[model samples]
Target: MSESFELADADRLTVGTVGPPGHRVFYLQAGEAGRTITLKVEKQQVAVLSQAIAELLADLRAPEAIAAAGELLEPVDPLWAVGGMQIAYDQDDDRLILVAQELLAEEDADEDDAAVGRLRFTREQAAALVARGEELVEAGRPPCPWCGYPLDPAGHSCPRTNGHRPPTP
Candidate 1:
């Protein structure tokens, strides 16, 4: 039972996390001159969302249409954690749209209990968000270039290495 909101013309859009890699929490947030909204997001969701937004921007067919994306990644007073998210591009307005819905009790399937938030940003903003996402994700644990798996602080077992650790010099 929460109120829904929208940032139709937000000045900033960012995705980032807090804490150490294995103990981090991801978030997505947008804001305007005087309004801001933040929601907890999953790392997988961030990856998917970033790829989707990037592909959508590429479909615009006009590189110049993209504006400079602000690279800031901080949220102010997160409203709530998001349960589900949806995205689409408004062809008529040339805007990318993202919707985040507040998580409700699983047993409560009633539509009336849903609270949805929305964000509409320009293609430039979408591009910027995508870039930010890439930076944020890469900042985490460095992956094993061999098998493409995360390399643990104690070293990882690269399956490609035939169950052997990297040769110790």
Candidate 2:
């Protein structure tokens, strides 16, 4: 049988890693009408992400939620130590946001390991993230990857950077 999860009011959840560990970091955001509360942290993996969400859901309020997420994600992910959190936003309105920390799974105990995990995204959430990406692209922003710098195959120079090599054909 196929399983299903219903994410009610998905605008209340934003998940991702913060930055390098050794510091308190995690990000969470909850939107209302359109805007949301957002949080950022250092390094958090799937397992840690799960716990952080659970805690945030329980808190309901904004600050506590962010604090919990930050605490959980305070440590860097041993494997993919570089990741950050971002919450979707709708420019038409404003809303409350939250942030939190998280922990990883047992299988990912080492700093150089990979683990498979599962997450459920509601239709609205999926669409929102996608739309956000599209908006970025429309704004002359490059799609996500390679140090936040947009990649241009036309040998274009980047005003935000210098002395960079273009992707190899």
Candidate 3:
């Protein structure tokens, strides 16, 4: 059975990437006390998660100023790749809850065998995560103006052009 973590009142929760631009690998990390849990995630996941968190925060009172998040901690090893994720607000505790489920293999017999992680953090942390997520995403390769796909540093063959002309700069 895979290990799961419940980081209630986590001290740190953030998203970070490894490698350069087009070859980047994104990760979702949460830590409490001395324990840190890292999960592999996709670039699109980070972008969508940031948008969702921004919308959620907008519906409630704004959070106070938060300290800028630092770079990813050393030994960034992910326990599992994230498959599905969920976010919700806990009015009673006045905290944001993020739950990430491990990606299961196709041949796995029991769906319940997949590990799950739950992180409860304050609005400040959530806001910081949103900010960092947006920054990381924007730092990557620019998107194609026509097709909305990532434009390769070398060159891109945008489908919108039907290969009749070069990709839009």
Candidate 4:
């Protein structure tokens, strides 16, 4: 069985990416003390997570200033790829909880064997993640005005225009 993690009162929680815009790999990282858990995630996941966190924060009073920016910890190896995630607020503890489940192949028989990670963080950390997530996603290649698909840096064949016109630059 894969290992699972529960990071309570985490000191660090952030989303980051590596590689060029068209071929980037996004990651969600959380750590406390010396143990860090990195999970491979899709760009869409980051975007949605950020939006969700922002919505959750909107219901509460304004958070404090964001913490100082920090680079992704070294050895950015991911324990697993995230298939699904959830976020909730603990009013009593006044903390935001993020849960990520490991992605399992459909052919895998035992769904319960999948690893899971639970990270509890402060509102400031959540705000920082939202800001960083948005920045990283926006830094990627611009989208196609016609089809709303990401335009390739080299070329792109927009479906709206069919194959008649050359790819957008």
- Name the top lDDT candidate: 3
Model 2: per-residue Cα lDDT over 90-156, one tens digit each:
2233222212222335665552342221223333443343333233224442432434544554554
lDDT string for model 4 (1-169, tens) is: 5689999989998888888889999999889998898899999999999999999999987787898436678788999999999999999998999999889888874769989899999999999999999899899999888888999978888898886896555
Model 2 TM-score relative to the real fold:
0.24
Prediction RMSDs, each to the true structure? 3.7, 14.4, 1.4, 1.4
Name model 4 segments beyond 4 Å from true: 167-169
lDDT at residue 29 of model 1 (Cα atoms) = 80
Q: Is candidate 1 or candidate 3 better by TM-score?
A: 3
* Candidate 3 vs candidate 4, TM-score winner: 4
Question: What TM-scores do the predictions have?
Answer: 0.77, 0.24, 0.93, 0.95
Residue 23 local lDDT, model 2:
27
- Give the backbone clash total of model 1: 1
lDDT of 3 at 21: 90
Pick out the ten consecutive residues of candidate 4 with the lowest summed lDDT.
65-74
Best by TM-score: 4
Alpha-carbon shift of residue 33 in model 4 (angstroms): 1.1
Ranking by lDDT: 3, 4, 1, 2
